[model samples]
Target: MELPHSTAPAADRPSVAHHRPGRARRTRPDHAAPRARRPLSAKVRRYLWYTAAAVGIYGASLAYAHLEEASHQAVQATNAAH
Candidate 1:
């Protein structure tokens, strides 16, 4: 069975508009100016570094505690077997 095709011309038919090859459509208009971002101050940067360091330390301590508990359990298992 053959599908019936529209006899209307290509321009007259309702179709989705295609973007040009290798060009992306912009979300914002070209005439709109972008907002300027402020740079972080020295004190704010220091605080961020301190917070990151504290988080890393806390994660390391938790990992160490888990490993310690695993080792303690293994020792107890060995003693029970003996």
Candidate 2:
């Protein structure tokens, strides 16, 4: 629908940058910025942290299981002796 006092048509809008004929239009190439590279030491440090975390979790779970088994075996041994 056409609004009141709006003389210009919607299709005739000039909402874009106008490049002059004599000037070069600005352009961006695909590889304007090089891919960021993580330092070798930083990568190694990250893997080490991950390895440490996994090992810590595994060790904690193993210790818990061992403790539980030992307590159960001790209870059984005492019951058998009595």
Clash-forming residue pairs, model 2:
none
Q: Which regions of candidate 2 fall more than 4 Å away from where they truly are?
A: 1-39
TM-score computed on alpha carbons, candidate 1: 0.57
Model 2 Cα lDDT, one tens digit per residue, 4-55: 6487766777655566634556554765787789667988899999999999
Structural similarity to truth (TM-score) of each candidate: 0.57, 0.44
lDDT of 1 at 57: 100
lDDT of 1 by residue, 1-82 (tens): 6545655567867566555634546455665787788999999999999999999999999999999999999999999999
Return the lDDT, model 1, position 10.
Answer: 79
TM-score of 2: 0.44
Each model's lDDT: 0.85, 0.84
